[model samples]
Target: MLQSSVTPHPERDRLMTRTRRIASRLRDLRSAAGTLPDAVVLLDHSQHVRWFNHAAEELLGLKRPRDRGRLMSDLLRHTELAPWWIDGAREPLNDVTAPGHPNRHVTATLLPFGSRQRLLLARDTSHLTRLEQIRRDFVANVSHELRTPLTVIHGYLELLDPEDVPELAPVLDEMRAQSKRMGQIVEDLLTLSRLETQDHVADEHVQMVPLLASLRKEAEALSQGRHTVTLDVVAPIDLLGSPKDLHSAFSNLVSNAVRYTPTGGRIAIRWAPSESDGATFSVQDSGFGIPAAHIARLTERFYRVSSSRSRDSGGTGLGLSIVKHVLNLHQARLAIESEPGKGSTFACVFGPDRLLRGTQAAEAAAAGVPY
Candidate 1:
């Protein structure tokens, strides 16, 4: 064997020092993240557990080395979680009981990270869930309690003849209108409470043609020859869901279009196939358009773009909230598009699974119009 003497490169020492500094900083970051209260778990592309924090062990019963590299579904053992974790469902699962700890509830959220990696975060939500339950119970009870008195008051007012007291006729009319508005608010609250209890809609096919016709009539009646309300149902296909729920949602949108639009504005209701191969029912109005800031919170109960305008228009403010719940039950979503001072469009997008196309729809597809 021949031996050769070689000198070390000048940059070798500098390179080693830089590499050590980077590694030290990474270790410090990892340690800091491990101490967070929320349980954090990192999964590889195959959904095998890659790394987890101390909080994960305490909250999820995951043990180092034993649970490492195990599939999340195998460790969590929740039937519904796999779809949510793999299919990219945006909503977080709430009140998920931890393994061997029924009392400890958590809300879990999954986010896709670098490449195909996933980050699973879970936070204890037992206290928040309890608070939500209490709020729901209180709202349900109060709404139910107010219904009887409101009905009685409305009935008594109806019995009193306006012609009998001509001098007080205007006062009686105003009172009657205000009472009806209050009754509507209470009824809407009850509807929201009922919807909250349901996970999904019953599988009953709803006729779309008749529903659209009825809604158009309602919009015209509410408009009273003010706005020009038009219905352009490109695909008149039946939907597999509760007719009552769909009607309420559709009617609320029509009514809102009429209520918000100016006297000479145009309101167009359209039902057409979306570019994504789904069906969309949209209500577009050339009204005093909503501000961008208010669009996000439109579905919140009693939320209004302008409180004064909402009150003046006799809006219960629960209309959009009810629409949201109805769409959720039907496995649909409400998309709002608006531009201030121009117009607004509220579209309910339903997955293709909910559509039931008939021969007429095929003809409509060929002809490119539905009468």
Candidate 2:
């Protein structure tokens, strides 16, 4: 009777074999993940912790069984992480202090996986953060140290008359110009350093109308009647920021346009409303436009699109870098659009929180009328 019941089932055997292979592969994957230096956490659709690796246990203080099925936000308890997690992980949260290891700084990123699951990855960035701080400190110290010497040299050059040394007049003039440029460079560096160290700018009512007018006047003065410079106030909205910092940023954009645009070229400065109720200060110039490749790196310190051209234009190559730092402090962004031979546009965009509308304009909006 037992021998009669013994029958071969090939399909069933193959199915069992395949199941064993799948389980083995999953184990291998878990082992590999556990060995990774970066913290790896698997989450369910609701962002509850499903599983985590050894690194996650050490870095994020996620204990097995105890942390399983717990909400990620509840465990992390970071204000910045909450917004980042809720916003569908649009951007990474940098310099996050690890909950488990408070001394460790981590950059966290989230990515969607199969079956509505997600993966949270965090990498230690403490070393990078320290290195960046060191760089900033070095720049600030060097700039401070050089200021007095530069001032002395510039003053002595100013005292010397070019006419007194007629044979060496050209040399004297060139030396004076270069020394002046160096002094400006040092000032800009100090400004940039200060901006870099600050997390926010002073919240002051920045009157845009007069500021824009002043910027236009400065641009015209810099242009020296060589370019057609105009200002259009499309939106009569002010901003809440440090007036001095805002002026420096706006002036950099306007001066760049004036310096780069050829004679008889058109440079238009416009203050207008942007998307999401934000305000934008844009400088559009019909000058030699930047190449696509060079535009992304324009804000880097001492970055030059054309070294000879920049030097001929008397640019210290730090204007855009300073502008970037100033805008960052003001919670604004710089957007640059350019096409070769056609033109270029540099726009400083500020969020709605920074906008300050006049009382009349606010009343007009409430009455459904354009002011």
Candidate 3:
């Protein structure tokens, strides 16, 4: 009697088949995730751990059911991680010590997915970090070693009397120029190395009025009546940074303008206010503008748009790299706008935290400063 109505319903059979297929796919996905080298953690909107793979257990020390509702920040308590997490994890946090294994280094990246859910991926970058450190140390040592020899060669070349060697005057001049350029390159490398090694810079009241004026003077001297160099101070605000370091960064921008600009070209240097009470120091030049493709790599060490042109302009190609390091220390950024045959503008954008407007603004307003 019970087997009298053993008929299969087509709709129910189809639904059962679809459900089995979905379950199989989910199991396969879990298997794939468990085998990944990167730690994969699923987080909710509150940044609480919802689920994780086997790699997460090994790398992030996350235990299933035990760390299920625990805060991600609590699991990974890093100073730099807090801000990055709070800021929506827009950028990756690199070379951070792994929470589970202190000796290991990891790069953490968080991406948002369905309905405020986030996927946290932490990859081991310990080897890459060590390689970068080794490269930096090698560069510093080589630059230091080359400095003395370069100085000696430059000194002897300076002492050479062109009048004493009438027949070899041109050769002597060329030798002296080459030596001087080499010395400059060594000095730039040393500066870049030093900047790279430092995590922070001394914060002091940087008088922008005087600093901008001085930079303008340096630019004019470099220009030597060749280019029309001008300084415009639209924002009468000082900065909170190491004066010497700031000067170096700003001077590099200005000098690069003079070097790249053709004779009779216009170069305008401006200190202007930006959004949120921030400031920007920009050097606009009517020179050979950089191509769009080469713009991104401009800050890389020894990166050049035109090697021969850079050499002819007496550039070491490390200037932008140095500027990048300096800006990173100051929590600033460099913005480049260029068009071939039109012009180029290099702007160092500083945040509001680096601006010292309290005293400087009062003084400028009281004195009715006209820049």
Candidate 2 global Cα RMSD? 4.2
Task: Tell me the number of clashing residue pairs for each predicted model.
Answer: 0, 0, 0
What is the lDDT for 278 in model 2? 94
lDDT of each: 0.87, 0.88, 0.88
Write down the lDDT that model 3 would get: 0.88
Report how far residue 364 has shifted in candidate 1, in Å. 19
Question: lDDT by residue for model 3 over 18-121, one digit each (tens)?
Answer: 99999999999999988999999999988899889988887777888899999988776664456777776789888877775777888899998789999999
lDDT tens digits, residue span 116-179, model 1: 9999998877788778879988999999999999999999999999899999899999989999
Please list the residue runs of candidate 2 whose C-alpha ends up more than 4 Å from where it truly belongs after superposition.
1-10, 100-102, 360-371
Model 3 off-target regions past 4 Å?
1-5, 77-79, 360-371
**Cα TM-score per model:** 0.85, 0.91, 0.91
* lDDT accuracy of residue 195 in candidate 3: 92
Residue pairs with backbone overlap in model 3: none
Q: TM-score for candidate 1, please give it.
A: 0.85
Residue 88 in model 2: shift from native, Å? 3.4
Residue 72 displacement (Å), model 2: 1.6
